[model samples]
Target: MKTYDSISAYIEACPAEHRTLLEQLRAIIQKNVPTAQETISYGIPTFKLRGNLIHFGLAKKHIGLYPGAAAVEAFKEALGAYKTSKGAIQLPLEEELPIGLIEDILRFSVAAQTKSA
Candidate 1:
């Protein structure tokens, strides 16, 4: 599997169509969690504040957002329209990226991590 040293490198390697979406998602994460450290974890771009805040990556036909199980459950209603598993949400490439929802999730993650820390 390919490995990435940084988030930018990971985004750079993605297909052009997905690149813009990933960049926007990265920006949303950064704007919401200004102090979180960015790194590659489990082969995906991850944000760490008190701990693992969130992770995101390009999927075959969607962008996968990993915010852990609790966060997924907490936002279940808001996430109903998307595909979700235990700790991941798949935002389809064809749809307009949910910037507001992504921002809310990032904020929720930051708050949750901060409280547990």
Candidate 2:
């Protein structure tokens, strides 16, 4: 696997089409928790504030946001519009990105991580 020293490097590695989405997602997470450290975890862009708060990546047709297992469960209703699994929600590339919802999830995730810590 490739190793990156920073978030900018990781974002650079992504395809050009994914750049905007990645940047948008990165901005939201950073805005909510500026102290969070960015890293490439499990081959995707991950953020760590108090702990492993969230990880996101570009899929063939969507962006996959992994906000931990608990966050996925808590927001399952809101996430129903997308394809999801135990820890990820697939936001389709062709659709308008749900920035607000993503922010809420990130905020909740940061709080959850803090509580567990």
Candidate 3:
């Protein structure tokens, strides 16, 4: 995969149908973590605040949200039908984005990062 220097470039490389969703996701991230340092990490769009706060990007079948293991564990019960791993959540392309759940996760991430710092 090609490396991206900016989030816009990464989003641009995604399928045209996914761009709006990716942009919405980016807006949510910015709204929730206004102080975060946006950058590309692990070849994906990432937000940093002392450490890596979260990483998100488009995928073949879903948009991957890497909020690390802690967030995944904290929100596991609320995850319901979404696919999750140790540190990642896969939001399928076919479904509408869960705006409320996403906001909660983003807030939780910011709180954790703040407490740690």
Candidate 4:
């Protein structure tokens, strides 16, 4: 599989009407966590700061944002409407993804990582 070094490279490769939205979300995550490392894992874009913090990807129906186990547990109520696994939360493209909620999740992920270490 092709891997991208920077989030821009990933954005440039995305093809769809939602490309802009995905890129915008990526930028928001990067902006809020400037020190995070960008990488592609499990065919998804992931950010690591101090430890693995989050992962996101585009799907045919929605965007998959994995904000770690802690975030998934904390946001269970808000995320209950979507399909989810142990470590991922599916945010449909039809719905306006909650940017503030994602940021808070990132913050929580950072703290979780620190606590575990």
Candidate 5:
């Protein structure tokens, strides 16, 4: 598998159609967590504040947002429309990206990370 050196590179490596959506997600994360550090972790884009805040990547049919299990559980009710696993949430590309929900998730992640730190 190919490895990306940065978030922009990772986003660029994805299919052309997914670029805009990935960029939009990146912007939402950045906007919500202004002080978080951006890096390529596990070959995907990750944000870190006190520690890892969130990671996001493009999938075949959706965008995967990894805010860890606690955040996923915390927002379970709000995320009922999307497919979620232990630590990830799948935001389908065909539907409108839930920017508000994404922002809320990011904020919750930042707060949780901060509290833990």
Candidate 6:
């Protein structure tokens, strides 16, 4: 496994095809959560506010999003088109990114993290 010190480093290491998508995603995340700290956690680009807020990464065929298990379940219906696990959602690379859904999930993560902290 590799290590990354920053979000740009992680995105730069992704495949060229996914680089732009990841950059756009990162921009949306930053625009939505301006106060969240950006860092590499668990070898992925993670955002932290009260704690860990959300994570995103480019994989072979998809973009993986980690907003924790609770957020996944909360937005299960809206995420029907994507492949989701207990704690991660796989957004397909060929399709357009669901920016609105992602922002809603981020809001859920922020609210939950804030309450716990």
Candidate No. with top lDDT? 3
lDDT of each: 0.90, 0.85, 0.92, 0.82, 0.89, 0.90
Candidate 4 wrong stretches, greater than 4 Å = none
Residues 11-111 of candidate 2 have per-residue lDDT tens digits of: 89878977888898899889988999988888778888876889987778888888878898999898878888998898898887798998889778878
Kindly list the per-residue Cα lDDT of model 5 for residues 2-82, writing each as its tens digit: 788899999988999889989988888888888889999887999989888899988899989999999999999999999
lDDT at residue 21 of model 5 (Cα atoms): 89
Clash count for candidate 5 is 0
Question: Once superposed on the true structure, which residue ranges of model 2 sit more than 4 Å away at CA?
Answer: none
Model 3's alpha-carbon lDDT is 0.92
lDDT of 5 at 97: 91
> Would you give me the overall lDDT of model 6?
0.90
Give per-residue CA lDDT, model 4, range 63-97, as digits (tens): 88988676888988877788888888888888887
Query: Tens digits of per-residue lDDT for model 6 on 5-48?
Result: 89999988888888899999998889989999999998999998
TM-score of each: 0.96, 0.91, 0.96, 0.87, 0.96, 0.95
Question: Would you give me the overall lDDT of model 1?
Answer: 0.90
Give the backbone clash total of model 1: 0
Better by lDDT, candidate 6 or 3: 3
Taking all chains together, the TM-score of candidate 2 against the true structure is: 0.91
Q: Give residue 85's lDDT in candidate 4 (0 to 100).
A: 84
Error of 4 at 43 (Å): 2.6
Model 6: colliding residue pairs: none
